[model samples]
Target: INIIMDTLAGLAFAGEAALSRYMLEKPIPKDEQLISEDMWASILINGSVAALASLFFLNYAPIRELFSRGMPIESEKAEAIFLTAFFGFFVFMHAFNTFNARTQGLNLFEHILENKLFLGIIFLIFTVQTTFIYIGGDVLRTVPLEPMEWLYMVMFALVLIPVDLVRKWVRNVWFGNPVQTRVNQ
Candidate 1:
């Protein structure tokens, strides 16, 4: 699961980096260069997806049954721990990646409204992931999750946003407009 999460992060990072490069190369007025709204939208969309996916793992009975083939567990507590760790780690990692890709050497809060295509791609990827996990059934090896579980997942995944926002705020205060400096040069 960690490997899968890491691979997804790497792909997301590479894609975002390419998009950022393209955006930087485009000739736009300095005052109009920020992509703040689009960045926020991307972060929210990707974070929500991770949170929703994690919810599916909350109802572990079905998952354990599916994996164990109905065999009794040696220890239910151990199983729960393993399941939580596996799912939680993936959720947080992906959520972190969402912000990581968007905030690379850029002031997230200062970007006005650029990068709509990047945001759209993130949403598209999330929609596909959700569809496969929920509707793909046996083909995807996923169990249908309850609404409450989804709520939990969404709440958990959103935790990264505020944390990253704070980090970006600190960077802005300390570093003093690195993005604008690059743009000016």
Candidate 2:
């Protein structure tokens, strides 16, 4: 199930990336744009809220079991919190990616690849840590993380805005590139 979902998610991500490229390249009239600031803002706000809610619910085992049992919350009150959390995180991440790609469709592909590099580093570190823990025969339970971890996440989020700004600036100033458009003469 995980493999299937992972494959499907990749396909969907690729299609979305392609669509973003098309949207970026397709010329807009004086009015039309692929993504408006309002739209992106709303998506970001709502997605953040939903992701938080998912995390909260997932932390409660009763909620998780309820959904897994396929019982009504009102009557049986069973919830699959993990499933809900997974879907929530999955959807929000994709929405964020789509919004992020709106202004940089051509470079969106490049950014995706760059992000993969970062993700790979993160995963490698995590795997090494997990391996060391397992070798020591330590139980794999959630550890209490430092406040710095949260601070780091916040910093990362803040970094994205400036990263985009820098990319746009470099593209336009140093590279003399305009917004991506199809049929560049």
Per-model TM against the reference: 0.47, 0.29
Q: Which sections of candidate 1 miss by over 4 Å? A: 1-96, 104-114
10 residues in a row with least lDDT, candidate 2: 136-145
Q: Candidate 1, TM-score vs. the true structure?
A: 0.47
| lDDT (C-alpha) at residue 172 in model 2 | 62
List residue ranges in candidate 2 displaced over 4 A. 1-12, 15-142, 146-148, 157-161, 178-184
Q: Which lDDT tens digits does candidate 1 get at residues 1-185? A: 44344555455545443445446754768788476653664467655755665565555566444333244644554454334333444545464456555664444522413545445545555565556446755564454444554444456555556555555556567765446555555
Candidate topping lDDT? 1
Per-residue CA lDDT of model 2 for 1-185, tens digit only, reads 23323443344345333444455564568877787554464456545644565565557656454344354544422222234333433333433344344445235445445345334433443344434323423243223222443232233234234445454565566655554324363
* Residue 178 Cα positional deviation in candidate 2, in Å, after optimal superposition: 4.8
lDDT of 1: 0.51
